[model samples]
Target chain A: MSQRVPVHVEVNGRGYDREVEPRRTLADFLREDLGLKGTHVACEHGFCGNCNVLLDGAAIRSCLMFAVQAGGRSVETVESLAGSDGELDELQLAFTEHHALQCGFCTPAMLLTAKQFLRENPGVTDARRIREAINGVICRCTGYQQIVAAIAAVAQAQQTAHSIRIETAPPVRVAQDTR
Target chain B: MLAGGQSLVQLLKFRRCRPSALVDINGIPGLDAIERRDGELHVGALVRQQALLDDPQVAESWPLLREAAGFVGYPETRRRGTLAGSLAFAAPWAELTAAAVALDAQLDICSAAGQRSLAAREFFRGPGETALGDGELIVAVRFPAPAPGTGAAFHEVSVRHRDYAQVAAAAQVSPDGHGELVLLCVAPTPHRVDVSEALTRDDAIADLLGRLDPLDDVEASASYRQRVAPVLARRALRDAAERAHRRAPA
Candidate 1:
């Protein structure tokens, strides 16, 4: 029998200290230990990106990493996407409005993956780049067209909001008037 | 041992590897540097695959590594996968293995005994095998800069985007038309072929194809690999030569 190791990790902005088997995956640690079932495990391997989560603000396959490896690291899962009041974020709202999911097995991973992509490539509207960003997560439903559309819509909206913020900024005033 | 548990963890889950204990190397400092010194690009073992891909130096200097890295597992896996870990795993179809061999990179190995450098060509003994002995760890990999006016290209045909290649080719060419070509997923280890002569010449392609000994795997048939190997080789060579010519001094 293997020994259980203590792992101190911050998940979804809350710190947790638990003793877990060395072999336990981060995906299992989140789902079973912390009861964060939003992160799904499909293939139990790296091939299916259903178990993806943000490690130090980068997307990584949770199943491909041991829980002990995440010690002292901050992990963000799909649970972090919604607010404490249960309000969906922009991406989730776009996913719902665009009908980007069917069976929803791959939704959490898709959201996290897309979230990382948008964070990295802000104001990106290229469908090809968006498709490539989420290519790791395998979705057997919706044919990926709606997912692409939903991500594009969010990106477009973000770009518009950014430009508006820039355009509406107050003008600077000079102390000396030169007429 | 673990740098990034991208592959080792999966192996553990599948019971393919049952190590008594795992030494996590992710916390080690200075092992993730990607820098150039002594005319060689040094990539530490802790460097993630995505870090190498994102390095502007790698993209500007050793573009072949960038091209090959793009075909690795996926964005998620690459963010956690380490280049040295990939070499240690030594999967026959791993793109970085072929890129290392083609670039003639050197792996810096360390152990209790001492340290030594091994050529990438001599690193892989077979699928999932290497010359590394017990207690030995690959600390970093050093890639020598290619000659000036040289260009490199990598090409592969997978069942799906970013999937493991059925047959892949990595090539580097100089302005003088001299080059090297390495084929992946066609042999037990990366198979290097002489590409000094232009592939367009008669019998050149035939001679290159004759050197391959691909096997029938579940992903593809031996005949299928044989058929596509030459096409990829030609395309890679042509693209590399064109790049070399473009970078050539006027």
Candidate 2:
């Protein structure tokens, strides 16, 4: 049997074609083949919650998934959480401002997990719920308080920004007949 | 065949499930559907653990499952773990087994040869074991319709929120006033105990711990399981019974 299998996939909106072994995990694929080192792996097992990335927009353990399994699917890594021009997204900014990470090992997974959580639950304002939603992203250094605060701050900002857009709507200029 | 890679991939990485070739089943259409069919909710093979808890219809129709779903792996794990996959893996520590036992669920499986049905209780034989034959795969699980006045409660004691429970308890009260109590992670597999007057009596709840000798593992001791099993059983039964009463009709 051939050792390597062909795979075509999209990562962070860019398409790529690559060959991977049947047993090669997606984590190894991104970090090694694609040079997307932003996604880190700590436990290698699924328990540690590092190595997390969005597959077809849902967060999953890349360490537990083979690159062949991700064939034809779109993956969004921790690197995708940053803006196109290299600016950090809102959650990333909040994590930086709040000092949500100390060692920075779990930050990539944390950001992707929090990004999905925030996007899925934009209307949710409960700090406790936000903490629970991101519970899977384990942070050994932050003690979780500041991390929760960071996510909560972003959620609050989103809510405030939404209300501001609603309250500051421009007056409707009715279309008039131009003779 | 791989449905959820949560367990299978880990096993593969550890040189456990080195099946010559893995048939990825994620592309099977309509396998992800969680729907109500003929008064019973059919949970397809690809239904994620997170979806069972997140769906309002499922949460309302099957509280036993909804509550138990929370005690499974972490959110990230559940985001990929499937109910059918858990049952197929047949891990005793799995929350789905206890819920299936309490809910009296049925398993539907198929192979290139044919199709067949098995009771959830009979499907599980031991840890990492099931009645599934070679070339066969679980297709879907059927949960009984919610009967009036029925309520459920689940409780588990774990070292951490996301870690598997050293011992877990799930109790379901039928509308007719009988309750099925299931205990997990203590034996080779989760088994149901016939608790007489389970909803009202403390003796029956405590008797749940007497059904088996706990297995000692890295997370807990046998003696600890013996002591804590009853406490979790009592809480589960009490909450289920009380809620069942509130939901019961005149």
Candidate 3:
């Protein structure tokens, strides 16, 4: 048997310390070790982005990283999307309202991937860019049309909110008018 | 040992390779920098593909690296895959290998014996193979600055967007119309061809294509690569030439 290594990681805002086999994947560690089953694993390889999770705010394929490699890093999984009261976030609600998922096996990863996309590209509603952003996560269901729509809807809402905030800002007095 | 385990971890899961001990190099300091020294860009071993693509200096100067990096896997994979890791993996279809060869990048290797430098062209022996001997690790890669008024472009055709290229071409052209072309997925290693005159001569292009022994795997047939390679080479060369002319000083 291979020796187990000590791994300390922050997942979903909680710290967990465990001793696991050095070869264990982060996907397996999250599901089996921590019972955070929200992060699903389909293709053990990196081909399918089904195992994507946020490592320090950037989306990464958990299956491609060893559990020990995640030591001292912060990982955000699908479980972090909803609040403690089970209240869904804006992106999650958009997914449901737009019917972005069907079989739901790829939903968790898709959400995380989209979350990173939205964070990197603020208020970008371009369908082509959105498709490119989530291109890693292969969805056998939903045809990706709804998923693109859901992300675009959120971006559009954010853009409108930003404009409203800018318009409502206090006006600056001109020196010439004061004189 | 691993920098980015995007490929190594998958191999482990498949039981293709088993090392008694696994070394994680992600915590190593100073190995993740993308620095500019003298006239070359020195990319450390742990610099991620996405980080290289996002570097403004890379996009402004070494556009070929940026373009090729944009074709590697996807955002998530690029976030975890390192440039040195890609070169060390030496996958035949890896875009960075083609870019490195085309740009004449030099790799900095080190081991207990000491340090040495190897040109990118001499690094690859075959698929999943490199000139790196036992205990040798690639510390960084030095990509020389493109000549003044030089521009580059990378083009490839994959089964899907961001998939492994069936055949890809990377080209860089100077204002004088002299340049190099590197072809990927058309040989066991990234193949460099003389594009200084081949771009204008059909016979020269055909001669270069006739020498390639592309793989006959499931992704694409060898015949298809033979048919598509020249077209990609021409497109990349034309685009690069146009950009080079635009950047040329009056």
**RMSD of each predicted structure:** 1.8, 2.7, 2.0
Fill in the DockQ of model 3: 0.89
- TM-score winner: 1
TM-score for chain B of each model, two decimals: 0.96, 0.95, 0.96
**Compared with the true structure, what per-residue lDDT tens digits does model 1 show for residues B1-250?**
9888888877888898898878888888999899989988999999989987899988878878888898888988998889999999999889999999999999999999999999999999998999999999999999998887788899999888788789999998878887888999888899898776655573576565685789579878888998899989988988998999999999
Q: What is the lDDT of residue B37 in candidate 2?
A: 92
Put down candidate 2 lDDT per residue, B1-250, tens digits, no spaces. 8988889888887887668878889999989989999999999999999998899887787889998998888888898889999999988788989999888899999999999999998988888989999999999999997686788999998898767889999988866778888998778889687786556667765654575678798889888998889888888888888888887877
TM-score of 3: 0.96
Q: In model 2, where do residues sit more than 4 Å from their true spots? A: A171-179
- Chain A TM-score per model, please list them: 0.95, 0.91, 0.93
Candidate 1 wrongly placed segments (more than 4 Å):
A173-179, B199-203
**All DockQ scores:** 0.85, 0.72, 0.89
Q: What is the C-alpha lDDT of each candidate?
A: 0.90, 0.86, 0.90
Q: Which has the better DockQ: candidate 1, or candidate 2?
A: 1
Angstrom error at residue B141, model 2: 1.0
lDDT measured at residue A45 in model 3 versus the true structure, 0 to 100 = 96
